[model samples]
Target: MSTLEIKDLHVSIDTDQGNVPILRGVTLTINTGETHAIMGPNGSGKSTLAATIAGHPRYRVDGGSILLDGEDVLSMSVDERARAGLFLAMQYPVEVPGVTMTNFLRTAKTALDGEAPSLRHWTRDVKKAMGDLRIDADFAQRNVNEGFSGGEKKRVEILQLELFHPRFAILDETDSGLDVDALKIVSEGVNREHAKGGMGTLLITHYTRILRYIKPDFVHVFIAGRIAEQGGPELADRLEEEGYDRFTAVEA
Candidate 1:
């Protein structure tokens, strides 16, 4: 199985105030078929970690290395990371004004795979995935995320995850802005794709509700740009009961 390893990663971003450090010597490893959850309060740098892994331009690597199967991921370009099987589902998806969803997905799949998928198979697979995600068939004809609701955009992100079949998926608070029903649907979509046993998942969220549907093999508590605690699924249960009060208290 392939592995994505982050080693003592330090990251910072430029703000009006100047370069501000967001991640401080953070490290983790995930293998295909493993599900890891990152839980923390706002400003704890969960999304920063996700963006860094996806090679976002806003975040600069100050120190440390990210490796995907021993390849220097930090050295690769953003699209190179995706081609290398790294995927990120943003906290807020942006709209592409002119690109239709069908064209966009096919183009991306072609880029990732270095060839076009068979028309017959691609059509069938896209239809099946959209149906499974409960997305309206007409969404295929719409521009990417254009005028869609928050929940719709999030589901579309999972649609890409399902279609692209990345080795590692970094979901940055996908649970946000989703109601109970949408939450279950989106979580089930993630779980369905993950069940194939070929994709490692890094699910970042603040609540335990999504954990109820998408169980994580490991749960990490992020505090002040570092991992303050780590444990198995049971740790999620405890976090649900006690919240991050104790951890933040310790940090304080």
Candidate 2:
């Protein structure tokens, strides 16, 4: 099985005040067939960790290493990282004005696989995935994420996850703006991908609602950019009842 390892990861961003730290020596490891949930309050650096892993330009890794199966992920460019099988489903997905979803998916798959997928199989798979996610068939012909609602964008993100079949996926608060039905649909999409036993999921969120559908094998509490506590599914239950108040108090 493939493994994604993060060791003593310290990340920061340049600002008017100079570099400000966001992730303070955060470290975690995820293996294929496992699901990890990162739970925390606002400004706790959950999304920062996700962005750092996906090689986002805004966040700089000042120290530490992100290794994918012993390969140095920190050294790889964003596209290189993606080609190496890391996928990030952003919390706020941006719109691509000119790219059609159909073209984008096929092009990305070709890049990732180093060859074009068979057109017939690709079309069938995309249609099935979209249907499973309850996405309108017309969406394939539309520009990427253009005019889609929050839930629609999130579903599209998962659609990519299903089609791309990355070794690991970092979902940054995927359930944030989804209603109950949309949440279940999106969660089911993730579950379907995870069930394949080839993809590891790093699900970052603040609530336990999504946990009901996408159960994490490990639950980590992110407080001030560091994992303060980690446990099995039981930890999520505790967070649901107690919330991050206790963790914040401890951090304070």
Candidate 3:
């Protein structure tokens, strides 16, 4: 079974003043068939944690280690990490003007599997995933995220998640910029993936609405780049009702 483990990870970004630390010894783990939610206020390093795991070039890991299935992930290249079954759905997905959805999905599948998917079955699989997300059939022909609405872009990310079937998926603020209907659809798609078994998820969000549908196995309160509290689903409800005031005030 696939598992992701982060051990006292410290991430920083390079600037004119040299490296500025962002994630300070943040650590967590997620096993297969589980869902973990990370909620925090803005600039609390939620996105940085996710991006660092995905090996984004902008973020540098100054300390700690990340392992996937007992393999050292911190030592691998970004594509290597991806081939090792780690996926991150960005908060602000970029628009690839010339790459059609079909092409992008096909390339990703090819890279992940180390072989091209059968053309005969590829269309069917893409169509089925799109249909599940309530995406129009014609979307496959459009350039990735180009000219798409906020909700549509989110759905496209979900589509890629379903198609890729990564062992661990880090969804960063997926519920952001989505309408209630769009959020439900995206959450439903995630639920379907989790039910497939052996697929773990790390969902990062500031709101609890998506949890109403996806239901996290554990909820962690992230404050100041560190996990302040962790508990069952009730933790999510409490945060939604009481807000992060009590938790933030303690540190302040």
Candidate 4:
């Protein structure tokens, strides 16, 4: 069964310009153990779709439904959505000055589990996740994302992904601002998670390079505020060859 489903979703945000619509009747579904990729040009509503799924306050869902594991997601609060097994990896991770990584992770772990992990077990799990991501053990003591490089911040997000082990994840531009080495590392972490059962992913990206490392079962092209095209991996190839010109024209 599909773990995540977005049906005829309509999203808009209040801007000085007006009620700017970002997603217009967007619909998609991702089953467990599958990876779906959403590709689009700038202002095509890809990121807006991701943020809406994550319960961002600014991106209001004017219509349609989001379901996770057959439950209504639109009714859930942001933290409730997280606890209900949905994760979003942001393009721009915020830095916290005083909150250490360890503390932040522990809080998240506790919140998701509804109980605290024993000290010994918690330490072991945290160590294992960090090791898998090649993050140093000492990094847990640093403030969350503070003074971290772009690659490092992305790794931290992946670390959270591993820790949360959500049923589904929406990675919004996770490959952006990464060097070759960092991209490989991030893709490797996502691969590792997918190798485990009961996890689906929706990877929102503009470039096809990241798709080379993380092959998607489905590829969707978004233009304006709706899907312009969709298919298998071959769809990604077509986009690479033709660019977004055709889709943009359709949008127009």
Worst window of 10 by summed lDDT in candidate 1: 242-251
Poorly placed runs, candidate 1 (over 4 Å): none
TM-score, model 2 to reference? 0.99
- TM-score of each predicted structure versus truth: 0.98, 0.99, 0.97, 0.97
Better of 1 and 4 by lDDT: 1
Q: lDDT ranking from best to worst?
A: 1, 2, 3, 4
Ten-residue region with minimum lDDT total, candidate 3? 18-27
Residue-by-residue lDDT tens digits, candidate 2, 121-227: 99999999999999999999999999999999999999999999999999999999999999999999999999999999999998999999999999999999899
Our tally of clashes for model 3 stands at 0
Clashing pairs in 2: none
Name every residue pair that clashes in candidate 4.
none
- Point out where model 3 deviates above 4 Å: none
> Candidate 3 residues 1-252, lDDT tens each?
778999999988999998788888888999989999999999889999999899899998888999998899989999999998898989999999999988899999999999999998998888899999999999889999999999999999999899899999999999999999999999999988889996899999999999999899999988988899999999999999999999889979
Question: After aligning candidate 4 to the native by TM-score, how far in Å is the CA of 107 from where it should be?
Answer: 1.0
lDDT of 4 by residue, 1-252 (tens): 457889999999999999988899998989989999999999999999999998999988899999887899999999999998889999999999999999999998999999987889889988998988889898999999999999999999999998788889899999999999889989999998888977899999999999999999999999988998899999999889999997667656
lDDT (C-alpha, whole model) for all candidates: 0.96, 0.96, 0.92, 0.92
Candidate 4, position 68, lDDT: 84
* Model 1 Cα lDDT, one tens digit per residue, 192-233: 999999999999999999999999999999998999999999
